[model samples]
Target: MKFYRLTFLASVFLTAVMLLLVYVFDSAKHSFSETNKQFFQTLIISALILSVINYLVVDFLFNFYGKRQIQKISTILPEEIRDEESNLNFKQLSQKFTDLNLKNTTEIDMMKEMEFYRKEYIGNISHEMKTPLFTIQGYVDTLLEGGVENLAIRDKYLERIDKSVERLLNIVKDLDMINQFESGEIILNKSRFDLNEMIREMIDVLDLEAQKKNTKIVLQTTSNLMFVNADQQKISQVLLNLISNAIYYSNRESATVTIKTKVENHKVLVEVEDNGMGIKAEMLPRIFERFYRIESSRNRSDGGSGLGLAIVKHILEAHGESIAVESVYLEGAKFSFSVAKAI
Candidate 1:
């Protein structure tokens, strides 16, 4: 509407100026002859014709260039956002483009983060495998270089080789288990089991190891038999990992690792807490990340695959649950998770 209005006004002004020039020329001539009258009429008709032509040309150019620009912009937009039957709305198009750019930026950032983690994971895996591989190679080379003929040396080298092989196998096994859990390949065989009994069994299993660290494994609960419906084997692994970590990381001379369970709603809340070298506040968030360690030197010395907590997290998540942690830097850390009570 504005374009047409402006074009009409310009054409009218041009016509008025032309009429004024004709009037001035006639006045200067000061004649009212037939020839002068014909000239005046012809000049008036010419002005009107030129004005109409000018208006048409301006309108044609405006529509042509404006539609072309809209079409070019439409091509860059997603099909769903484009309007084919009508001219494009500039405001809507600008907002959509802004949103699309923001979405792309977020996705790019996430990809970069994932790539970083991938590289770090690969490096950690290489370092972990290389250490044991080198140890095994050294032992085997020594045995082949005449050490096999000695009775005691041969036995010792073979034993060390076996241990290295076991460690490698453990790494492979843990990796495979994690992959299975992540890919949804491991199906839970849920069953009714006594939570208290399982805690006792795990404590007994790790009793010897706890004794080495002078740590005591204690179970505290109000109920004797708190039954839960869960994957018994996986739950056992979770308990084992948490309990073992508690004993291993304890800073005290005689550490106390406690396993507690209580009834909450219709669920069983189980907690494994210890008076150990509690993890730093900053380290707690990444504690369940695969191959993440609080103290790398000490963690490696403990001969862990470093996938324990990660596996524990995966198992619990698969059972439609989540685990929580609490800790103070030097006091202790507690890991707790809930399971549905068997009906």
Candidate 2:
């Protein structure tokens, strides 16, 4: 820090020295005697030296007394950007540092993301627990108030309780998967897998639900045996969730959700395109956000908890892949994502 300050001061002093030489050549070069010219030059040099000493002493005192706090904190910073934090006499030092440097962008984004996850994890747990607690309380209250004698009513209460328990179990599983992802504990078992076959497998799993609504799932791909290198189980879960979401949100009787795959620019791309009611333009960017739902998609028929897309996002990101979407308000929606190249 001190050397950097000295270097700046030296540059200023060098400019002053040049001005003095120019002034002497103009003012005394033609009119003065050799002795007088020499005296003038000596005077300028003396003044320059004194000026530097005064400037250094003042700058040193100002830095030591006024900026000492920041200097103390400078120990935490990387050497190259120490000066940007040297003026940190205020509480917004971190904000100022973030605004000044590239490194801070990555760190600040991580901080904000971690903060978001902290809040979301708490909220999701509360929400998932609320329904079960309410069901358990209602069932216990009913049994205590003499409804237990009615075998059919008692069975109904038990069934509701069981349903709530199952949902809570699902929530716990989702939470466990998310925790593993955040903790860097999830290890992918990448292998060659038939992308088209996997889509067919997912369609088999969800085709009954689609049939009940008269919706059809069309499978299309550049190749039937387009192989992909990915964590087969994790990628399957992501694709299943996306395709199911598409099927669930399609409002028309003739709704068609297509699963397609291809090899593009050395990456294997998979897309789930649906001619559903489509997502709102405003909600497009935030759909993958945890616990977020398209308000118009209020029906339970839209499928499981809003955690599905968020889970998909984490799984893809964990595998160094990414997801994107395009939607027209009433026309359709397309979700495209890519995995590592097939080899």
Number of the predicted model whose lDDT against the real structure is largest: 1
The residue-by-residue lDDT of candidate 1 on 271-328, one tens digit each, is: 9999988989999999999888888676352478889999999999999999999999
Please report how far candidate 1 places residue 170 from its true position, in Å.
Answer: 1.5
lDDT of 2 by residue, 161-263 (tens): 7877777777778877877887999998999888788888889999898998788999888876878889999989998888888887787978999888888
Clashes counted in candidate 1 amount to: 0
- For model 2, the superposed segments whose C-alpha errors exceed 4 Å read 1-121, 296-303
Candidate 2 pairs with clashing backbones: none
Tell me how far the alpha carbon of residue 289 in candidate 2 is from the true structure, in angstroms, after superposition: 1.6
Candidate 1 lDDT trough over 10 residues, lowest sum: 83-92
TM-score top scorer = 1
> In candidate 1, how many Å is residue 235 off?
0.4
lDDT of 2 at 293: 79
